[model samples]
Target: MDTQSAKDTVDIDLGGVSPCGEVIGDLGDDDMVTVLTGMKLNLAFFSEKVANLRNFVMHLETLGVELEGFVLDREDNDVDVGCVGKFLEFDLLCGVLGSEVVELDRFLDTLYAEIADAGERVTSCKPWQDNLLDPEQCLKQSEEQFSEIKKLSASFERTLSSYKRGGIGM
Candidate 1:
């Protein structure tokens, strides 16, 4: 328990949960480094989920446009149950990400109004991905969700970037 020991520096408790959500453990400096690296890896996982969301939206658009064409020209893609399922899945994902989007938007709105707000260092993460594989295209489909999500994503990223660049200070 001496501060000279590398393990003493981090105050880790493998036996109990810390207020920060990390487990209390006898962590050495090396272990702390590993934890940080793991956190960075988790961030990559979040980015991939975001990309998956993007990919899904693209398919949704494709489906919607194709469905619209079908409606007009009698091409008939909606009669397929699978397409409906996929759209439903994207809707659920949208709900999940959109909640975070709302929170992020609000945080930015208030944060930006501050005269000396530090740019957001909030590290958001998606804990899981769930819902829908119902496809109508006879193959992987995501165009309908793609178009819808792309707009929200663009707005989110633009605002985030502005915050990063000291928009609050301006």
Candidate 2:
């Protein structure tokens, strides 16, 4: 899909505005810890997000397993080529999906650990395993995660720009 069309699917507009400028401008030298804590908390969401995706992929694998077993259990040696091909294709897709989920989970785990360690220096910004029972809570959590991600991106962009401008003092 083209860029505009792809964006239209979600339908969120930036209007060329970025939070980095506002966030960076609002930060004082003393608020570095706060900023770092916020970033760590925001980044920790990766673990939660990856875990959710892992669950979904594993659920897909379950369906694939059930369907494959059903087809194989039929003692008929003359299965249609199309049906066999579909099962094989589904299995292949499941394998790829499963492997990707594992890799992402591992990556998220490592990053989460690092962020947790860093967060200890400021405050514990660990992401919680949200067991939201109510729909309202779920919606609230989603909005909060989205805000954190946006803030994290803004802070990261600001930091990168600062380093590029020779302000990092390498």
Candidate 3:
């Protein structure tokens, strides 16, 4: 059968319910499938980005610790001319890291909004009843990933705050 005819058949089989479900409004099976697949792909892409961000934050934390150590080591010595340049460099680097954390916090906010929107879309589609998608599993996976990102982001924020408080050097 042609695509249009096949869609008509499916619509008839659904007893007036569109294959896309009532909330989605008048989309055919192919369209619904495309949307669902796109949602899954987006979730996976965001999850990977979040993981990379987590790694970046952890690396920053390590750098902060090492810089703290360097500052402590220098504290015992008399202030040398060379130390002024090192302190300036350290201040500049800290400023860069602080700006990056602000950017990442904005990114996390966007991710949270996307996840919430996707969750609403997933729940609205009667996927479990229609056998269109596994809503429970998809939601569970996204929630788990989101929670992990939130926790990591919070920890990074705390670390960044301490760094800002002259934990490395005034």
Candidate 4:
């Protein structure tokens, strides 16, 4: 196709609010490809990250429970053998770890719901002549959804770092 005709036909108006909530204009084939590809990549990354987080949470919970049991199994007289300090340490650690694990589980639930919603939107879109689907509403919804995931991912990373630094209460 000629450049002019291609340009004219390629323009797709997804008409919606911008990332900053302002009005948006037309999106060309290139723009659509960028958005679509970005959404796809975001979904993949988000899924993997969530999976890793869930595995980590599970491991931490199991270790926390086991540590609690071990501490409880120690007799009172064992404190003189340095078990007292160990028990106290495990008690505080488990409490903090348990709360963090709960928070992570809640985050996973919310993230999974958002991912499902985005997947539904993507599946609902019908393709154009060139086999590209660029529903404006879906793109906008996806952009918003992706933004949320990015924010959540950053927050999770910060929390993980805090934990590494022994800031379990974080």
Query: In model 2, where do residues sit more than 4 Å from their true spots?
Result: 1-73, 123-170
Local distance difference test scores for all models? 0.40, 0.45, 0.54, 0.46
The TM-score of predicted model 3 comes to: 0.52
Model 4 steric clash total: 0
Regions more than 4 Å wrong, model 1: 1-27, 74-170
C-alpha RMSD between model 4 and the true structure: 11.2
Rank by TM-score, highest first.
Answer: 3, 4, 2, 1
Better of 1 and 2 by TM-score: 2
Error of 2 at 82 (Å): 3.4
Candidate topping TM-score = 3
lDDT tens readout by residue for model 4, 23-85: 334444445456556655554554554555556545545554554454466554343334334
Candidate 1 Cα deviation (angstroms), residue 65: 0.4
lDDT of candidate 2? 0.45
TM-score of each candidate structure, all chains considered together? 0.33, 0.39, 0.52, 0.39
Clashes of 1: 24
Candidate 2 to truth, TM: 0.39
lDDT of 3 by residue, 1-170 (tens): 96569767765444323444554444445655565566556556655655665666566556656655665666544454444454455455545555655665576566556545545544555552343335436545655665665565565556556645653333
lDDT of 2 by residue, 1-170 (tens): 75447556976544432222222333332354454445455544654664455465456556555545645555545455554554555545545554654565465556546544433432322222111123224434554544454453344344334433532212
Put down candidate 1 lDDT per residue, 1-170, tens digits, no spaces.
Answer: 44336346765544433223444355433444355445434334434545676765566455445533433443323244543454344444445656654554454344333211111111121111000111112111233343456576555445434423532212
Candidate 4 similarity to native, TM-score: 0.39
* Predicted model with the maximum lDDT: 3
